[model samples]
Target: MRWVALTAVAPVAWGANYYVTHEFLPPDSPFYGAALRALPAGLVLLGLCRQRPRGAWWWRSAVLGLLNVSVFFVLVYAASQLLPTSIASTVMAVSPLAMMLIAWTLVAERPGIAHLAGAAIGLGGVCLTLLTGTAGVSMPGVLASVAAMLVSSFGHILTKRWNAGTDVLASTAWQLTAGGLFLLLVAAAVEGPPPSLSTSALLAFGYVTLVATALAFAAWFIGLRYLPAGTVGLVGLLNPVTGVLLGTAVAGEVLTVQQLCGLALVLAGVVLGQPTRAGRRGGSRTPLQPAPDKSAAREFSTRNPL
Candidate 1:
């Protein structure tokens, strides 16, 4: 489906994020990268969308951006400075579990036993992956990463809840713009003057802005419009998986058998968390019902398959 394809593109773009941050950007400049990546992209997207949000949509967009992008990026980049990318990513792997919990509490959307079990298994795998590291994990780094993921998860759940009546493009543009401004403020206060931007750093910034943030989020909204929320959440597991593989293949990072097992468990969890024919009965369904024409459905489905 169109949604599926669009959603699928997100993880692929995100997979390259670690490398772009670690290798391309200068050390201790993650915040700088975050600022550059978000602000311009936000502006571009906002210009393109050119639609104003009404009423509570503006407040919701700001809140979502603060949680999902500004705060999340700060914690993640800071944690990455102190922790290995793999470890940071492993910590992020718990996002689905967090989103599931939030959905249950706020929306009364109970996760089935399979979803819970899979989340538990996936979390365990994440723990194993973290434990396998010899470089002693910093407590602050662990806490920061976990906090980042939790906030990001909350943002995701909020987005799902709000997207029902909102204009996706307008919501996204506002959120990104808000997040960008917050990041810029942080960068100005905490990081002071930007470092001498190198060519690689510039490229990384461009990639993050154009590809990771803008394109990926656009794709995500498209996918969310068609898929079940849980399915969309579960598909996020691919993010770290692709990150790990790319880290190994491109960055020459080592992967032990335990880590491989962890990957397998994560994949298993994703599969188990997916909606079966029965499980899709209850949940927040997208209102933009597919057209009756099979060709229209097929085209839309190709871009956004559930």
Candidate 2:
């Protein structure tokens, strides 16, 4: 339950991030924006952890970095710029299903009946909230958001698979640092110089870097360390919930009674998917457990932790 609460922090921070990016950050410089957000946050965590990737972790970190940070960040930035905060965040709610399927295939964590049902209920709520018909939807933004969801879902499950014995902070820092540096190089080549920042933009970047990227990723990975991927993904339902409420409160988006009801359903789904003590005991082992088999890949991963 404490892990559930801590995991909730990531999506909530990410939810607020949509509004901040849409309202304050430079829209035309997504590459630079992503690079800036990831790099500083990575450096901060690296400073704290004071450890670098060793052995196969170097390549693993690079791959996860590309999927989770480099590409996903740019797509999310594009979606945030092109769509309303509520809509952009709602699109991401579909990631629970995606994560479930990916986890089933990649890590052999079968989706429980409760998890599937919760995803269904949560997705239905997403539709109800998203179909407000008040704001015009952008097709490109929707595509970008969906792409971000799939990429992130796969990357996150892969993180869980390989992060068995690693310090979550160190591994997260490595991915962010690798991804940020890659983005920086690419942004320099394609986007020209980094964009100039206004005072508001700098402040927005600070919040995005420290809170959303660094703290959120650490909390999220920590949850993955303890909980099943399906459970963590369902907890992510709060991302859109926060986006919708924040949109209503700060962005003056309409909060219909229907949307409020949808919020209830979404929260219910989140609650439904939480791990009971019985569930934890009866279900497949989380990544924190050592594998029973002495497979080469398992042995290799064990030898080169994180």
Candidate 3:
């Protein structure tokens, strides 16, 4: 339950992202917003941890940073502009299947019936909860959304497969910093000068940086470190659920009967998909082995063995 809650925190905070992005943050500035949300939080965490990338992790963090954070955020923002939240979110709902397949292939972790069914139920619930009428979806938006799912799923599996030697906090901070730095350059080139943020925008950025980006990523990484990737992927369903519920509660949107039913299905799916001590069967995984790089290899072997 504690692990489940930790995984849930990421999507819950992200669910609120819909509200904050729409209501408070500066419009037409996804890059800047993403950079702001990530870079500072990463810096603060890195400062506290005072942990540098160990050996091969220098390259590994850059790769993970780009896929998990940089490109993922950029594509999400792009999809939002091109498609409705329902469309973008429902597309993303397929990530659990992707994560499962990747996990199976990479680590030979077989999916249990409960998790498989839960994924289907949760995905259906998400569709029911979010999609209604037709969306003005763009081709680019569809591509971006699909790409986001693929990239993030692969990145997550890699996070599980080739984990870092550092503590969860420092590992997460390193990736965020790398991703954030990349975004700073991209946002400058593509978006040009940063837009002036409103008071509300500033406040929204603060919440996203500290609570959403910093704390949320910490919980997410912890989940990835400890829980099965499929379970973590299922928890992502909570993002749209959170957004839909928040819309009803905070944005004066009407909640339909279908939405309520969908939420229930999502809950059921989550419950079914949860990882338990009884459920966790030992699976084949590649162990982290040491190499010539004493710092990185030793850290990977001793600290982050699969």
Candidate 4:
């Protein structure tokens, strides 16, 4: 139940990301915004944790950081600049599909027909939502966004597979720290000095760093501890759904009848794809072993005292 609540929090935070980026950050300098958002948040989290991950954990952290933070943020921000939020988000809606493919290939975890059909139907709704909007879509932007989402999806699956037994807070802190350092380097080389700060930009930065990066990821990791990778992936559809609805209601973006139909389809598909408690017990699923208890922590310290 705690995990379910934690998982539910991730999409709401992610949905707000679009609003922050679009309304607050300067459209011309996306990489700069990405860097500001990721690096600072990572540093803060790392400082708070103060435990350096060692050996293979370092490599694991770096890999997760690159996929989840560096690539995902940069590509999504750049794509947003080139395309409408709706179109960019619609492309991102394909992440569940990518996650499904990765799980089946890597873990031999297959979804039932209902899951597949629901994902397809939801994707169709996303397409309709994009088509109904008045803004012209950019093919390059759409492709980039889709690619970024696929990469992020893979990272999420890897987190479930590799870090299932690690402390959620510690594992997340390491990934964010490493990923943030990488982004800082990218920003220095590509974007030069950060842009002049504005109040709205600062707010956006804080929201991205503190709320989106720190809190959102904490919740996400906790949720993944309980849910299947594919189920968690499907929940990502809410990110775009919330973005579109908020864009329309708050930003006064137009929503046509087609978009309404699309929203309905997406909602229906998500409902159909959700896993019931009974299914979780009886279904052929990957077992997510919980992290070690306090006794194991004590044993590790006693065995390898620094």
Best by TM-score: 2
Q: Write the per-residue lDDT of candidate 3 for residues 1-306, one digit (tens) a residue.
A: 687787799988877776676667765888987799889989988897777886778998899999888998878767765654445555676788788889878766676677788888988886786565544547798798789889989988877767634467777888899999999998999999999987888898899888888888888877876777778888988877777777678877677788788888887887777766654523323222211334545764344311
CA RMSD of all predictions: 5.6, 3.0, 3.8, 3.9
Q: lDDT tens digits, residues 59-111, model 2?
A: 99999999999999999999999998888998999999999999889888887
TM-score of model number 3: 0.87
User: How many clashes does each candidate structure show, in the order listed?
Assistant: 14, 0, 0, 0
- Candidate 2 Cα outliers beyond 4 Å, as residue runs: 281-306
Q: What is the TM-score of each candidate against the true structure?
A: 0.85, 0.93, 0.87, 0.89
* Candidate 1 per-residue C-alpha lDDT over 1-306 given as tens digits, one digit per residue, 9 for 90 to 100: 455556878766765776677677666766676777777877887788776666666677789888878887777766766666666667777877787788767555666676677778888778777788466778898898889888887787767666654456666778888888888888888889988987877877889889988888877776665665556666777777877787788878788899999988888877776665543533434232222434323322122122
Instruction: Candidate 4: give the clashing pairs.
Output: none
lDDT of 1: 0.72
Residue 149 shift from truth in candidate 4, angstroms: 1.0
Model 1 regions lying over 4 Å from their true place: 277-306
Best by lDDT: 2
Please list the C-alpha lDDT of all candidates, in the order they appear: 0.72, 0.88, 0.76, 0.74
